[model samples]
Target: MKLSLKKFIKHFGVLVIGILCMSAGVALSKLSLLGTSPISSIPNVISNITAIPIGQLTIAFIFILVLLEAVVLRRQFSWQNLLQLIPGSLFGWFIDAFVRFFHSLPNQTYIEQLGLVLMGTVLLSLGVFLEVNSHAIIMPGEGLPNAIALMHQLKFAKVKVYNDFILIGISLVLALSFTHSLAGVREGTLIAAFLTGRLVNFFTEHANRFVDWMTPATDANN
Candidate 1:
């Protein structure tokens, strides 16, 4: 029981950090007007069109998308998957709102902007690690990549790249229709893929030992 509690704490902590980091990255990407990854890009596009709060829009859209994914994939519904959305959306909203309060900060010099971008990238990568290590059910956008990997017997990283490309394509169409622009899509592709991919590799390699130790707990639950 003590071992189980310790494992739970570790997993839960990672999960919380991971979800928030992901949302923070998305929020920063949106602020840069550079767009986020494919899954996150949808909410940004909707926010641009409807002028609704991006956080609220994102949360709602993700919930709907998760539902669609479950239906399409015939996945069993899980509370953890649904719960994961809460932190992501709430953190995203907090990021957007927090940045709005400091509008002038993002409008810095090229170097400064680059720093913000890098910081955002780091935060996002941390989030990814946290969430992936959590033994709970995955959120929808993430699940899509996992499903694809499972179906094709490909690496999760490669599957993610494919998913990002899909987002880039969708964002392009949306940008053309809404504002005749694709700044976010372009930037998200170039930056997010590079940073997120590198981070994923780094963490996955370095954390394997730790992950192996936790595997038994996860297996027991299964």
Candidate 2:
């Protein structure tokens, strides 16, 4: 029992670190001032036009995504999916906190902004890898895709790619419709979109050693 508890704690630790990485990724992406990640572009654009906090917007958006998952999943949606709200909400708040932490960062040149995009993508990828490996609840950003993959019997990687593209497209429409030009959908957003899914897959393949060290043998059962 003690060993099981210890393993459980390590599992939770992995999830916590994963969430922090993702939050920092989102914050750094925003701080780039070029654009944010695709999953964040809609909230970031809405935040820009409405002057509301992106984190708060993110909470509402995540709620909507969870609902959509229910719709897509229909009979398959379960209490476990609902459990995602806890981490998802915390994920939003974490983003707000990290954004504030880097709020004082000075403006950067185009190259420097791109550099942040690369770094943020790396963090997002690692976050995603750890999150999946931890075998815990996922934020709706990842959860929705997982649902789609399960429902449609599609490859998770391919579904994730499609999901990312769809989100970027929707965010582009929102930015154009509301802002009448552009907002958070930009080159940096494109960079993140291009890199995130691929990078995540890369980490899942190559970075398993670290995650395995942190993960318990019976993690799959838990």
Pick the lDDT winner.
Answer: 2
- Residue by residue across 71-154, what tens digits does model 2's lDDT show? 999998899999988878887899999989988766568887887778888898788777878766777998898889998899
Error of 2 at 124 (Å): 1.4
lDDT string for model 1 (67-157, tens) is: 7555645655455546656655665576577457545665356566555666667778877776777764465667767756766688987
Q: Single out the weakest 10-residue window by summed lDDT for candidate 2.
A: 213-222
Per-model clash counts, in order, read: 3, 0
Off by over 4 Å in 1: 1-4, 75-104, 148-156, 213-222
Predictions in order: lDDT: 0.68, 0.83
TM-score of 2: 0.90
TM-score of each: 0.79, 0.90
For model 2, how big is the CA root-mean-square deviation? 2.6
